[model samples]
Target: MTDDAVPDLRASDADRERVAEILRDALAEGRLDMAEFEERLDATYQARTYGELAPITRDLPAGNGVAVPPVSLHKEPAPTEGWAGRIVGGEGSSTGAVAVMSGFQRKGRWTVPRKFTCFAFWGGGEIDLREADFADREVEINCIAIMGGMEVIVPPGVEVVVRGVGIMGGFDHREEGVPGDPGAPRVVVTGFAFWGGVGVERKETWAQRQRLKEERQRLKEERRREKLEREAGRRELDGSRHDLLGDLHGRHDPHRERRRGDTA
Candidate 1:
């Protein structure tokens, strides 16, 4: 979307926090008085749309910069994670996870089903899909947290929708409306949170990062070895040239035959 389209878009908690940070900076710098800061802080939390948040810090520098963001909201660039390749159609490796006064984790190289469910009671669970294959392009993850918490982690490029109810708790919708890659999977998070929270985050996989690191190291080592070999080859060529020049000038002399013929 264009810059003009941003104002009408729904604002995430991150947007609100950005504005709040600017207001706090203004207060610390004496640009705003205590009363003004208090009023603006309250309004910042109540803001729901980008348009509503635009005016809060209209006169102040954003994130303590002359050139700031969200003061002029821009559409974030989407990353390509080769979502089409990850969408392997078949049965999921596993379906669900449960935690009762304990914790559970669903991560690593697994397949996510179309409708996977999880529950937590006085406990917590983690559903990490960074390295997961998908049973379908669109999948649903249902979570039920009671007096506990559940965290769902998805890689970037995936679209997320949170339709869960939270009473005295919350379901994180920060990653919503961020847009997905063309062939990326759409994950719908639904269910109930009673005195608990379900948090959704977009993060790069540790496995991917580690693999990249190792590849870089391998390339570096390969280059170093090639450089050493080239230097050694050059030294050997120089030594052979020196030996040939010494033989021509010293030990194997053609002048000795000429001298013998003159004597005869």
Candidate 2:
């Protein structure tokens, strides 16, 4: 990719860092060899800006390397005990989160509210989310979403990663880790109508946030305990040193010999 393509895609310094992250994931997943990774990464670095990144993605080949599938969205309920209960919303609006994986080869737009998390996938292709619009809210796309073609947009302060075929891009939102068995599905090209959009509102339970906070607190408490233990050990050592000095002084004192002579 050269600096002369896609003149409108303005990316910041942080965006450049994300590009590196995408490349690293691709290399780790065996999508790209060391040499290719370095070459493309250098190209990206030299591009000067996001506008320069467009060409590299424009002429990329198919099978964008990784696999993305639209499996049923699942939610892991927050635990009933402690902090877990707080972040997990009440029973009324408790759906965990939404993930959309596709193999689309055409233009599509899904206007999302600022509160929800969105993930899009494409294969053998260059997909563009550079125009993805959002309000004043944070969104996270796990790095695995972009496998084939690459283009992602976000409001200022929103994060994004792009991975072309043989390159990996995106972020990981799940605290536990990437979910499920990794298997590539047969290539299926399915098309659909653009009508009423699919709406999903995932409410984070109070319990969930509570649990996260508690976990953090627990870590902090553990550190505190370790510090206290170390201090106690130091105090014990100091006391032992004092006792030893007192014993030595008593043994060396000439007053003890005078007392012994008087007793005799």
Candidate 3:
């Protein structure tokens, strides 16, 4: 005789539709994960009375149910002070000028280097752009790196877009060459980053232009072996004849031994 004085049973509509069928059987046995089943189905539609719907109807599932807890997502690295633009859903957003390098700590694993310059346009989550570095001029990154590694230095035309897979065990956008001035300002790296390592040098293709033409033919054969050992010490200080067949057989064998002893 202590259940709220056990004397007032006035719930209608078939007992509020049997407590909304036990919160839809605790959201179909999964026990709710769709954002807590939409916040307990919007608090059971803004419950007005009945002690505010009796603790979401006694946390439902008194019988057949129980199971739901698996939501892991981690890919951090987006915060600057001077000029980091457009990092959606998570935070940090700038428009025009920026140049920041905020404070982040991590010594055990070693982390601290976001000296400003990040620009992400559209992403659902998960992004770690390998400490992010986009020299800055204009940018638009997408999806974000689930593991990390993203670097973009825009200036030419200033347009870049990486769609997926920026997972980095190492490298991304690490650029250096591209400044011989061909009417600069025109760069655009697009999508599907399913891995890492992409250094853009005028839109490299043909196997990265045959591996940069075999690394510029091995640096022009090491500058032609240092210009033939500095031209063999400037051709031994101009004695000039460095055995070109012993100076052409020492002047043609003394004119062929005086014409073979005057034709004998």
Candidate 4:
């Protein structure tokens, strides 16, 4: 049977559970409010067929509540074009950085390999990928921070998955679970931390910020020009009306004079 036909069939507990997961993702992504989520969750459990379940999340970003395909562990990285062009499989420009008592940084125009490792002991390190190319579609950044800190900054549209553990320290995964753009590389962050922290943050590059600023300025100028044009049109319309009324009055004045003369 075709995939669409499956929806007509009865939905099992696993199907409901899958829909629930999608709902959870939607909620986390701020797609649904608490009231809508509770309503949908109740409907999901009571759903008997895929058809009934599909409409609950049909308008969501997850696409009709269908389960997401699991990320394959053994799948080979495939070469692609467009945004994926940034993912050129090869050796990384730099493999790793170590800071014992100071700091290290990897930023700008570098190549991130399939696996890049870093260590920090009583120091800090920064890995910025705003202007970097990926050596593979899937790359892992292994961080080991001991009584120190490490920060990984990525540009918008890149997928980030954080699976690191912290003991008496923390892994800042505020950017985790956010969906990435199509054809963008996926970043997997994993490692350990002891008495230190590793942070993963997503930010717009300088160029991107500049572009947004220019776009806003352009839009503002356009709106201003439009308002000016509308005001000019209104003034022209009022002037025309005034001229037409004056001409009518002038024509009637001669007739009024003739009428008065006849009366005299």
**Number of the top-ranking candidate, with lDDT as the measure:** 1
Residue lDDT tens for model 4, 78-184: 32344576888889998999999999999988999999999999999999999999998889999999999999999866879999999999998898876665577
Candidate 1 global Cα RMSD: 16.8
In candidate 3 the C-alpha lDDT for residue 115 amounts to: 28
Write down the worst ten-residue block by lDDT for model 1.
Answer: 71-80
Candidate 3 C-alpha lDDT tens digits along 183-222:
1122334443333332332232244345435644654575
Task: Predict model 2's lDDT versus the native.
Answer: 0.37
True-structure lDDT of candidate 1: 0.80
Models 1 onward score TM values of 0.51, 0.26, 0.18, 0.56
For residues 117-204, what per-residue lDDT tens digits would candidate 1 score against the true structure? 9999999999999999999999999999999999999986588999999998899999999766567899999999999999999876
lDDT of 1 at 83: 70
User: What's model 1's lDDT at 141?
Assistant: 97
lDDT for every model?
Answer: 0.80, 0.37, 0.37, 0.79
Worst 10 residues of 2 by lDDT: 180-189
Which residue runs of candidate 4 sit more than 4 Å off their true CA positions?
A: 1-79, 99-103, 121-123, 146-148, 178-184, 204-211, 248-264
True-vs-predicted CA distance for residue 7, candidate 4, Å: 16
**Candidate 3: global Cα-lDDT?**
0.37
TM-score (C-alpha, index-matched) for candidate 2:
0.26
* Ranking of models by lDDT: 1, 4, 3, 2
Q: TM-score-based ranking, best first? A: 4, 1, 2, 3
